[model samples]
Target: MELNQLISVNFNLRKPKSSTPTPLYMVVYYVDDKGMKVQAKIPTGKKVHPSLWDSKRQQPIMINKGIDLTTNQLSEQAEVTAYITNCRILVYSEKNLNFDEIKEKINLKENNEMSPVTQQFISAKKTPKATKAMEVVLNSINESNKSENTKYAYRKNYNKWCEWLRDTKQVDSMKALSQLKFNEFKKWLVASGATNAMVNDTCGYIVRIIKEIVNGEGAIYGVKEVTFKKLATTSTNVKCELLEEEIEALKDTKTISEREEFYKNVFLLQLATGQRISDTYTIIKGEYDVLKDDNGNEFIIIKNKKSTRGAKVKKSYIPMTKEVSDLLQVLQGNELIPTNDKTLTEYVNIEIKEIARRAGLNRITPNGNPLYSEISSHYARHTVTTQLSRKGLTSEQIALQLGNSKEMVERVYKHETDSDIIAKLQPAAANTPAPQVQAPAQPAVAKDKDLEYYNNLSDDDKLLYTKKLNDYNVLKDDFFKSLERQPERKRKAAAEAKTREIVQVWGFEGANDMEYKKLCFFLDLIKQDINDLILTYKVYNDEAPQGGMISAINDYERLLINIGKLTYYCHL
Candidate 1:
């Protein structure tokens, strides 16, 4: 009988009592290729029975006597069933049966009939060694002497590797494990579309597992040694910077949105004070002081929260310009902005990049990523230093204001000296030198005819030409005089006006009451004289009543120019 026939067979057996006559009811059937068939019935439940060949006498014979039952009683019974059941019975012919054919048939039948979960259980039972090894590795990872997070990462990587090995490589027995085999597995990992970082991490986990198997309590489990070729580090192409126009454009955006307001204030504060995002978010109200120095020059003091030990500890004391003061006033009421350093930095960087993209300032690198250039929130400090340098502040002076070393200012900032800055800041030389008039030189001794010709010209024509020349000369004189007075009187006048404004705002009662009061009075008097000059120039230029008017206008203009120069000096 074939295995397929045996799959559907059902049978029963019985043995007779000692004294009772056995009832003959059992039946057997067999078939042959020659169309021959046979059937037989023997006394049922009889251990031993005889063939009924003779009528007068009955002969007794063992049930297995005629059959070729070479093996044990169980084998004989199994063979009888195999013969009667019409199924393939390879187990009866185990020696002559093809092992591969039998295995294939068995596997096919099992696959067709078994549930998925049952199949998994059979597979697990078959690979008990590999399963036990995996458990040991997992246990070692759980009891690792590393940080909690590190252990967690290791376990995650290990589980992933184990799953891959089981699913793809069909890795089970200890003898199948090898470094060469693992190298192939690594290639598969790359082909499996894992990222470079992921591949590295997975390989790292495998290596750690091998190490643990070798050195950890799981050393008894056979684990092969692994050597991996290190993967290259991927570059992080991150760009963060604001453009000049973008920074300028931020000033015009005035939405009441909290994010917008936060960004604006943060940006303005950074630009004004040159503070980092980290330090800017933590600035308290009381940390700033708008006060005068010993020389009575007004300055803004900012105590840095991020200062470390062994560094220059001086607070950033910038001069309180109108722009800076206005920004501070706007931010005065809020306790803190709605962001921390990391978020603000990231937000500003993203917005700056977006702004650059919108403004057509987005620069692309050779590799097609955004190029790193232009201004950022952090660049505000450099901008301030550069602007101050442009305003003719010395490196030392800037360093003092920024609370940095002069060497740092010169090296990192590349700050120019006051003289160098002045050279750049000065206006290009004006054309034609204020329209000078050339006086006619005396003519060489002329013949009598030449002299007679000179006398023949009309007096009206000569008078008109002379007046034009004189007027040109007068204008030229006044222009030079204005230039000469610019460094002194005009600047002084402006300074005095600003001083008086400050005093009035502060409501000082009298000039002699305090040093500040005296300074205010002096400044006011100087401002009054400068104002009078300006007024006189306005009056003279408006109505040219007489020749004296030109002289007065020129004088007042000179005084005004002087006051402007004096103001610059006073600020310094």
Candidate 2:
């Protein structure tokens, strides 16, 4: 039906119960967006005798004194016309407005008084001037630089909140989203079978959007700051990861069915990329770049769907190791890329568990769940993160490969226990010699052993070491200062090689045999060099530093871990 035919109104006479005049009644009927018919009858409070009523025209006839409408009757006709116009505007403006809401807006409950809309219409103020947080959120999502998936998630969360309000017969307003109701919403999601992580994410998005709407800088909405209790995550620390051997087993297993083969390949692709299932699927579908650096080293770069909106690290740069390159080739050859479907994760999760079981990964986790039972597409990321951290990649390097923040990698991705730490350090401890008692020294000239070691070096060796250190510093400074004059790729590669050479020449074996004072002194020098490079790259070049600069900084940060010092570095 045409939009103009959506609503109709008619004025008719009331039932003739008395001999005197009968009042006029207004009937409003319309078809809502959901194809439901709605109607309401409103009394006009103006009457005409039967003889004076013009049945055909539906108005009082102008048959001299007895038929002509009185002043009050004339006013009633004008008010009814305004009501009809206001009703049309409301119906046209709001596609989701239901009949009950329309009745309230048009004053069906208090028939004698004009509704807020009708009153505003008569006063020529048809539209109200106020911002609704819900509408603001929708508009913001539409306008944001967020990926389509992220935008859809935000919209879904907002729509779910609205649906809950409607189901609970509560008003849809910012004031209605109280702390208690927010908590209840979390419970409701879990009861509805959502995982604890899903519940937390949904709630977190809602809170973030509402907080922006209410308290953001220069936000003119008249909403108060929304404060809710921090929800404690109830998710157990179940080991949702496959062991290295288990992964290899899955890789070598013969698939019993085509579905198992497809999902297994998909899972392996995820492990290679260390991406979310969505991103892994995207990469397989060829929505990625395989570019080679000046050293002819190929790497894959992808715009992370989750971190596309004003994120500091928007792209994941994964070195194209033989494993990753070979897997990509196999996936391409077999046409094993997943379709872009919302149910892809669910399907992959379900199928991969059976695949794992078939491959003999039947170990149980500490949480008492079978390892295959805990296996899912997401575990690929956890497994990769843990494996990379174990292989001595610093948090920053892992974060770059995974497209996550360094802090996030350390706090959430690198999963290690106290025993794991002890196991790693035990070898170095075993190699160190026990301290020996020294003969009594003269009280006036107690020697600093670390300083003494530094002074004992040959004069020529000291000069060469200083010259190499200064040359490395000058190279970094010149590369940054002349960034516009040279090919950045070539300059960066050279700078990186020089950095490695300088570190190698120093022969600094961290934490194994170095004394505490000597370690601190060298650590201070490394820290100073890192600071100088940061200033050169960020302040002077006005561009973020990458590759070797990041490697050096990460090395310094990791060394801090052995020394039990706080790891602090510039965000860049």
* Predicted model with the maximum TM-score: 2
Q: What tens digits encode model 2's per-residue C-alpha lDDT throughout 72-170?
A: 455545565565556556656766665556555555443333452234234542232222565676688789896555665677677667656655545
Query: For every candidate structure, what is the RMSD over all alpha carbons to the true structure, in angstroms?
Result: 36.2, 29.1
Worst 10 residues of 1 by lDDT: 3-12
Clashes by residue pair, model 2: none
TM per candidate: 0.31, 0.34
Clashes of 2: 0
RMSD of 1: 36.2
